[model samples]
Target chain A: MTDYIVPVLLFAACAVALRKKENAYDLMLLGAKDGLKLLVSLIPTLILLLTAVTMLRASGAMEMLSRFFAPAFSVLGIPPETAILVLVRPISGSAALALGADLMAQYGVDSLVGQTAAVMLGSTETTFYTISVYFGAAGIKKTRYTLPAALIADITGFVVASLTVRLFL
Target chain B: MVMSWIFTGLLALSLFASLVLGNGSALAAAVPQGARDGVNLVLSIAGSICLWSGVGKLMEVVGFTGFLSKLLSPLLHRLFPSTRQDKDLGQSLSANVCANFLGLGNAATPMGIQAAQRLAKRSEGIASDELCRLIVLNTASIQLLPANVAAVRVSLGCQTPFDILPAVWITSLCSASLGLCAAWLLGKVWRR
Candidate 1:
């Protein structure tokens, strides 16, 4: 963590130096321009997630789902919020992150829930939702097992975040 | 309406499931948490959206993105042979590539959209191979920095947020490589 700034600075420097002919700050500005295009595509996803999140909360369905998954997650040192990640992945990453932060606040850091939320945050990619929205807009006719591979990657990330946090943090 | 209702029911179920893990008292406490989460989610998404849109319009004006896109031209040229190697598509793609590396999801989404839109415009009468390839590439992107992941780690109280940096690069690169391979194979086998 202490050395993070060094790498970030170096990255900025290298990214700048490598493009010596162009201005580094300009690249950043360019990066920001790129960011805007992403904004357009993500609007629908945000709407979907917000609706889903609000409905889920008011309906009291979150509790039931949490109870069903608690035993399994508890065994792994995870709490309710962590289990939400599994369900939340198909919804929206940013929303899932919001929920994860919520869980962290409740369970207190160093608890299983906080750790799991952290890991889930780092590990998984939104599959059914993000892929569909992105590829759909792009006019991709075939997914070609892209979803399966990403799911596998998400699982790997979840497992890694869990074990690493447990052992190291 | 029926499908939306069904989705609403399903969402209700997911919420029900989220709550039962703790005592009912926790649910009351969770109200504020939910509100806070909602707000954060909105802010992050909005921040990302604003940042990226500005970036997109800016790069076009500055010409920096044009320079970067040129480097990928040889590969892009081959894949998108049917479409002319024009600047708009290339610019959109360069912006997207940079956004992905930064872990700016909201920003990447629109550029990806623009790239597709631009390609569609260029393709005119024919469905181009490069366009298909780019979609796969977009979904299976490498995301070199994984800033979001590191930030999550830090917030979770990790001594070092970037401890997973090496691991992320390796995994994302490998996965992206595989995705590219799969895309290539799909393009070849499905070649028309």
Candidate 2:
């Protein structure tokens, strides 16, 4: 039900814009060209981040990190499996989503781990990817303070999602 | 930059760890597979980027973005004081925020890129505070509905896909607010 809002809003916006008798198609084409340009600029950074994350995961570094963090995460009321999910989440949404579904399958959806995964996934953004793509598209060379700030937010999201899941579910 | 260090650090760590853990084959496979995944992700998102960016362009042309800017100006102005003086920047940012609020992350990218581009124009080699703030905000986007997460839950056969709504609301709000605050504070400290 909530999914229709964006598509409907987009359709209405296009209709109204077309009704203005302006060459909306030309503007849209220009925007699409910009999107293509943005995509091209983003590819390198995307590949870099993707490769790095993949290597980290494949090398079992994420597992080690999760194991290392489990005690601390447990102290904070998070399950060990969720520690890795939280860590990987801000880096890649798809990776996090895959982990999230696995967690749900391992634990029932109503379980604390499953609900926490869902909430954590919902709360956090793909921080690194957003930074890379958005900043890359803008051709911003140096990103100062953004990464730390976003990571701090990621931490806050992790903590808050855990607490909220406990409280609500 | 800091990002380069992070990338290198992660890669070096992964390589060293793989050697120690004897996961050489998996590490070796990751490189090409990762590139393929990256390309696939870009391709998958490209169509939505074109469509939504096109629609965002139409909204800008029809003055809908202007209306959105006006509506969002108070909050956006507070968060992005520099944007108050730049109408184009504010409009693009507002449109991006609106799309993000609707959980239209793919649709929001073009406007975010447009806003970033506008902010980058005045910046030299280093990223401006405004650009940094914009990136942080986008990274901690506070969505009213997490449609994608809900959809995934439903596909997993959850009886109530949206049951996590309250948690989502709480978590997103906390992260976004805290992120913006951290960015703002850091910017002040760095400028001084």
Question: i-RMS, every candidate?
Answer: 6.4, 6.7
User: Cα-based RMSD of the predictions, in order?
Assistant: 6.8, 6.5
Report the poorest 10 consecutive residues by lDDT, candidate 1 chain A. Answer: A5-14
- Angstrom error of the Cα, residue B46, model 2: value is 18
Q: Against the true structure, what is each candidate's TM-score?
A: 0.58, 0.68
lDDT by residue (A54-145, candidate 2, tens digit) is 78778988678778888999787777768767766877665565556556655777789888888988888889889999888888788888
What proportion of the real contacts between chains A and B does each prediction keep?
Answer: 0.18, 0.75
Residue pairs with clashing backbones, model 2: none
As a whole number from 0 to 100, the lDDT of residue A149 in candidate 1 is: 48
Candidate with best TM-score? 2
Tens digits of lDDT, candidate 1, B1-104? 43365456656565555555443554455555455555454445454344434433343344444465567667666655543557677767767766665455
lDDT of 1 by residue, A100-124 (tens): 6556555764566575565556545
Candidate of highest DockQ:
2
Output the lDDT of residue B46, model 1.
51
- Candidate 2's chain A scores what TM-score? 0.62
Q: Per-residue lDDT for A19 in model 1? A: 55
